[model samples]
Target: MVRLMPRKGERGNALLVLYSALIYLFLYLPIAVIILFAFDAKPIPGLPLNGLTTSWFAEALRDEKLVGSLLTSLRLAVISAALSTALALPAAMVLAWLPIRFKSLVMSMVLGPVVLPQLVLGLGLVILLRAAPDMVGEPAIILAHTTITSSYATLILYSRFLGFRRSYIEAAMNLGASEFTVFREIVLPLIRPALISVFMLAFTDAFGEFVVAWFVAGFTETLPITIWTSLRQVISPKVYALSSVIIIVTLLLSLVSQLWVIRQTRLTSKAPSA
Candidate 1:
């Protein structure tokens, strides 16, 4: 009896190829559908490639309500992203700097919304706001978005902070730097990739959110809400077109941010050597 050591290299290559195909299919399948349906002249989605036309896109461009909703979505996303990042930066700092006893409890509390259904969170927020002075609008939407997205920001930033070389901050302090100054100068610059990643995640979550937005937003519609409303009335191909635009934009921004993070990490990894 003889035992042969497997050509571990071949197994690795096979696994890589399989994973690559799976990832590509997962990512591109929906995008392909969105693109195809976007150009489809027929309002109803089907096979046999209906005559290609730009009417859906043209209609999306001409739709003023859609435009308004998109603007609202953008504004909410930007505000939510900024507020979440601001809150997370400090919260993450605490989580990193202090050895908290209830770490799991704290992390779970922060990630409650992510684990819980958005519909449930929305319903709770709506009920809470009902007794107060009219609290449903852009403000309410932004507030709800911030609550959900801040947790993500905190997670991302905390990961970076936990992995960061604390000696840099310590060195800064040893060099007679103020605590705030050290954080601003050394800590911030080092963890910038995490900060940016969190900001983008917050923005994306806020922008794509439908449940929370629908529940909190009063009369002031966001893009997802608009799509929902339209979906009920008519399954407009323009909806697909609008979605395509959003998808493309999101993909572009995500790629850019990922590249930036990669570059920053590479720089950080090489800094000690330099």
Candidate 2:
């Protein structure tokens, strides 16, 4: 019997699958190495797998400096994400639903930080804050993170608002509801999932951020900055353990936020037809 050759479509699909596998391996190989090395018993994170052990995690947990830096990172991430969301929501609503002149220019300004290099933004912030040296610690880092993350929050919220049905607002208005009342009753609930997703995304970005934080942190050491400093001295097993924990936490947070965003999008799409 003659073996039938693969069709062209099947050949293309096989190539696509191979390409995808390669891409995933490229992206996750380092992460896999980090997780594997986190269990290495050796002080140095190197080959030969110095016998599997969990002591490095305990060492990382007990390191007072690492613990303090993790706490600082958490605080900064929460404050910055909340502030970014708070500032972006109203601006996004206005930009999406209201007619305004130079709207493209306004959006460009809001998104400028994303296009600009972090090193440049950090240096600029440092120069700007030099006038008031007192604001160089946690406040400066939070402000810098908020500036960067707010653009992302605004873009997400704007997309949600743009797709929003104006009929809801109009209906509430016809019933003698105030604008604030309409927003509180009709808008907030519908957009709550998007809001939460944006907040989580911002938190994830800020939590892992390092460059801008390094420049503006002054004496304050966030987890990323702490890790950077430690790496310069030595690639400790503790660092690997900490990185593994962070990787798990960040992946979980990002996955949940992305899933929530997708679910909210599906709900919104179905609502219009229903």
Candidate 3:
């Protein structure tokens, strides 16, 4: 048997592979640990597995506070996503297609929340909500979340509209279609994927938001606030279990969103020639 020496390019490729693997491991090892400890029979999450069990998951689901907070989060996320996307759709279209005076000023206001720190945004909302103390809980949370999510939603939809083929709209107008008719028949169908992507992204952002929600949540708790509260007391393995579920769901959502967007892009690209 003959031993072969690795070439210079082969050595570089091997190092690159090793480097990429290390990066991935660094990023994902903690998530893997959390997932593993979620199932560990140990009452507390830590190293050295005691035994494998699924009781934590059951316990997490059974915890009223956790379940309630999760439900609250879901409700807020859905409402925020829908409201933000609906608000963003028209704003995005106007920004992308129409020429208006003070465009820069208008855009700066629209995008202000995105660049502002969540801490500051929350504090500002707290001040604003002082006038109407009635809106300090779930309602306030929904408002704040929508405020943040709408900026992102607008950006996404604006980008989509910018890349849109104006020919379609023009063709509709040439055929004497009203603006509403054109939007209902032409633009909406074309941008359905983008709208869905914006909604999902907004939902995920609002669902995971902590600082803003914490400030406005008052007595009502969202999932992140609940998790933070739990951390201050005796940490529960159920938290880990719930977290693992969230992580898995988020990963699935992200993967699905990416694939859907890519497929839509490919279809849109082929539509013109077809």
Model 2 agreement with the true structure over 1-274: per-residue lDDT tens digits:
7759988999999999999999999999999999999998887778888699999999999999999999999999999999999999999999998999999999999899998999999999999999989999999999999999999899999998998888888888999999899989989988999899889989989988999999999999999999999878978889899989989988887787788778876786677532
Among residues 3 or more apart in sequence or in different chains, the pairs in candidate 2 whose N, CA or C atoms overlap within 3 Å are none
Model 1 per-residue lDDT tens digits across residues 1-274: 6758668898899999999999999989988898888888787866777699887888988999888889889988999999999999989889987999999999999889788899999999999888863777988898899999998888888887888788887788888999899878988888888888888889998999998888878898899988888778867888899889888888898999999999998998889731
Q: Sort every candidate by lDDT, greatest first.
A: 3, 2, 1
Write the residue-wise lDDT of candidate 3 on 22-67 in tens digits.
9999999999988998998988777777689999999999999999
Error of 3 at 72 (Å): 0.4
Q: Which stretches of candidate 2 lie over 4 Å from their true place?
A: 1-3, 264-268, 272-274
Task: Assess the local accuracy of residue 153 in candidate 1 as a C-alpha lDDT between 0 and 100.
Answer: 86
RMSD of 2: 1.6
Provide the TM-score for each candidate, comma-separated: 0.89, 0.95, 0.92
lDDT of 2 at 271: 75
lDDT of 3 at 271: 87
Cα RMSD for predicted model 1: 3.4
Candidate number of the best TM-score: 2
Best lDDT among the predictions, by candidate number: 3
